[model samples]
Target: MSSISIAWIALPFFVGFVIYLLPKLDRYLALSTAFASVAFALWLFVVQSPINLQLIDHFGVTLILDPLAGYFILTNALVTAAVIIYCWHSGRTSFFYAQTIILHGSVNAAFSCSDFVSLYVALEVISIASFLLIAYPRTDRSIWVGLRYLFTSNIAMLFYLVGAVLVYQAHHSFSYVGLRGAPPEAIALIFLGLLVKGGIFVSGLWLPMTHSESEAPVSALLSGFVVKAGVFPLVRFALLLEEIDPIVRIFGVGTALLGVSYAVFEKDTKRLLAYSTVAQLGFIIGAPTVAGFYALTHGLVKAALFLTAGILPSRSFKELREKAIATPVWIALVVASLSISGFPLLAGFGAKVSTLENLMPWQVIPMNVAALGTAITYAKFVFLPRGGEAKVGTGFWAAIALLIGGLFIANIAYPEAYTIANIVKLLLTIALGWIAHLLIFQQAFVKLPRLLEGFEHLIGVMSLTLVVLFWMMMA
Candidate 1:
């Protein structure tokens, strides 16, 4: 396909058009659109199409169908596709389908964009769509969350615009290629600006509330893909500039560990999962500074885990917790928990090892401790006993299938050749993590705090403050 021929690849455009034509078809809209979007995005990744261009002058509109963008798009589309299936079954209203499609397309555009202006437009579209999605059900809490998201995101956009202006002033063009000669302070500000979209652990107060309270599938897409939109730009910025300031390390790791710390006290299943997203993103952001390959691994597994969490908890969410105390659901939960904790060879472990291996030993220590903490917090999910079994729902089975497929795909899709050693290590990690959970943490699991009862806004406030302080200092 010619690169420009990708007008059809603008999956969201088609979705938006469909929504306008059939506004009442909310039920099937998200599912059907998601399927179409995923198929197109897959083609975008595989085909040798040139960079998709919409407009060009001194400042052009272009999409780089490169491996980097392909990686993010594939995961983003996969998550949306999985969550759309779950939503179809869960009976969520289709009124938000347009917003979901818009969000998906905007985020996908953000990933593939090759210039600052294009990337900004993509992020802005996603931000507006997310605000709508957050406020879709329009509860008082949803309204509040939506307002917070809208305000915080717009401010971030302003900062990004300022940085864009600075880059344009200095380089005479607004392109990723133009950022190379940009000064350190401008680069740092741009990075911080993008961090808002990424939902860095420190400044991401809007995530848990908006996502956890939104409809489940909305929560899934937001958690699984939208937050990741920020990371792509951050990575691009880091690559463009040569500066290796220590603040990047501090901000990234602090964000990851802080979120994980929040997860330790979080009781709400969805909220806890949201905090985990921050923690996982922390690793991805920090890893690239030290090693290159880890982000790829983390992106795949974390996206899968987020999608799985979003899919689970259809009705008896409350009862599901109670039943989990002594059922087979515990098995599924443990596998996911261990996978996220980097127990050894599971998806998380592969990401962690690949990420931290290249860092200095001392720098590696904090990450290791964070991984251990991740283990402890996730261990709380293992309330179901080893021997008990319960009936599985279609959603439950779907969640299981998604998780396995995610890992399998991650293992295969990685550019590096997979070795038996890696596979063996992953299996070993799963075994040990499970054994350790059963032997040492089983009692603690029973005693863990309830998800909703332990909620606090303190951590969110503190993290936001630190992020601001770091940005100011870097500026």
Candidate 2:
């Protein structure tokens, strides 16, 4: 079982290196490897047990196979496989495939690793691979975006390393289980660092620029899977740092409101989705189990949406409406948009309901408001005019089918989320969102200050966030 778990982490890197050596077979190799990884992860779900392995003196690596990790790994692998299928004919180079596989392996390692050191290593690997992937196309914009990502990521990782050193000093171990009763300062630093990567507001100010500027498939992977690398650790922090729930809740609410507010005003389609990603993280930071569910639903649907956006020929909402006339693609877009908006009977609805089920009454209102904002944001995409046409292919349809199917399966699998009261809440949120959209978002002049769009401003905001987080932890 332990070896199998390790295999899950190792397989992708191995296959990726091999594909690099044989560029002609890159597509076939990547597809087969991705499918095999998904199958193996599923098998691990059945046979794997939580196990801790000692890699060296006073240092050990742990593989946790609990439902949370299992669910994340399974969903991540599935999305990766789907993306590989979509990219098979996209004329990507061998280096792209190699980086994609490395990204997958790094993320898998992060999800399964139980020690802070291992998680940090996994995060570093993911950061490097993501930087390369973002810059893979070698466009001037992509290179700049990737550089911003790299700079912010390095700062985050530095904080993570500092926190890890503090943890080791305090507890003599870097393991999650060993960190009990450790200093709050150390934990705060670590959490704040992870928040940078987690796509929370302030620290995650780099997200929209990077996500919006990257190539379509890279954007899909970034929004869908890579951001969750930071999020998974945050979920663990929420569970482990029980005393800090209030702080987490406060930050979560702030981030949710801030992200949705920006998203509501944004006109670029992918940028809007990127801001929505920030808002959605707010829902997850305060609730652990719900975090997993929300991440799964969001990752799958977001990937499909980005891919669908790629098939269509527009970056602005108005242009997308005027240009996207393919029926099958439009249907896929609707499903993805509705799912993100928490429409009843969809995966997003289940995740949203379940997340709300865990929130406090005060927290509930902000969450609901965020949900409504999400609806308002997506309303642009769903209710827009449709007239232009683009060629749809097998990859697009196959990827869309898998993602939408996952939503239905999630709804069925989590029956508790399907209650009448939750359904009513979802309806109210959607209705309010649509009305708000008409009143506010539909106005031509509504726009946010473009200050947050600048890389230097974002760095300042991230610094301020760290100071604030530290003060909050001390208080």
Candidate 3:
């Protein structure tokens, strides 16, 4: 690895600080940062290796640009570019661009780190930047949700830190190899922390409110990249620790079902998409090998969906039905939503089929069920009218066009998805889901339990989940 590769992490941080000093240059700097990231992601694809990043004179950790991390960084780069491009044409402030660029840099850092201590540092940076990005709108609600995100995320990291301490005491290293001889309690704690951060099942109960209340572009970042921070590493570590794989997939299945159920019943447009983010996290988590590909496609589709939401007149379904949307935005929404729902001949179908083909037979059926639920969830928005011109700028279309293009580009992994058998199955899934949507959409909204709704409740759930993870690990 070139020592110059350190520039990958350092350059973004430097640009972010520069953005703070020269706020007037924020948009150009942010776009430049995105373009640079795209260039580096391309480089990592061609040449993969581990770089030892020395922070202090005597201290350093390894950061690898393995294919897994490369895939995620590429996805992160493209979505971040799309978002910055979208904001470039908007009336947004320099502060938003600066923070977003910082957030984008932090995620790239997190994706590249190979050791627990460095990963934790990167994750905390991501959390802080994410908190700032989501709350930038400064509404009372946005502020409240942002603080809630900070508090919960900090607690989760505390578990991760403690677990790292336990592992280091036993093995005296921060590398993933250090976890090789660590106790189950230690592993469980780390798993619990990552589970919450990864947006799995009860642990990720914070997702909907955080994503929905944020501005559209912010929501895109949250769903498309933020939650994947924990998931990418978790999947990597799971591949190392065989005992953790089934456990992660178990929770992954639960997350998919729980998220899609909420999405199917959701009335708010952004919130529904937020729920869909949670569901796709499940998909990515449930299949470790295909996760990079699945996450890439979903990330691209989600950016398109959330950005499309931003161009809309209202978030409420009733209001959206009454309003006429622009042709470009509407087409973007349909294509993105269908791709997300695993429609045949789309990026999502390929990813989904890859996931199913890789899963244990017993696990396949429930994942298919979740896939069906996904179709039903997106059905609510697929036919929204494409009549009015929304006065959006070319940058907006440019961003969406880039993401939609990436969707097809991502299909290189699963050409077998076009097989007649898989196509028929996916078609049937969508047809049934659409029928179910027709039946269910007319009913009043279903309310979920309030007992597990907030930060305090989530803390309790995390404890319970930790206990469960311990039992699973020890068994």
Candidates ranked by lDDT:
3, 2, 1
lDDT of 2 by residue, 347-378 (tens): 88888888888887788878778888899988
The alpha-carbon lDDT assigned to residue 32 of candidate 2 equals 75
- Cα RMSD of all models vs. native, in order, equals 4.8, 1.8, 2.0
Winner on TM-score between 1 and 3 is 3
Off by over 4 Å in 2: 44-54, 321-324
Q: Write the per-residue lDDT of candidate 1 for residues 216-310, one digit (tens) a residue.
A: 56676777778878877776655555454344556578877877777755656777777777777777767555322344445444544554554
The whole-model C-alpha lDDT of candidate 3 against the native structure comes to 0.84
lDDT of 1 at 32: 66
Q: Model 1: residues >4 Å from true position, as ranges?
A: 1-5, 24-29, 40-54, 244-247, 289-328, 343-346, 358-362, 385-396, 414-475
Backbone clash tally (model 1): 5
Model 3, TM vs. native: 0.95
Q: Which pairs, if any, clash in model 3?
A: none
Off by over 4 Å in 3: 48-59, 442-444
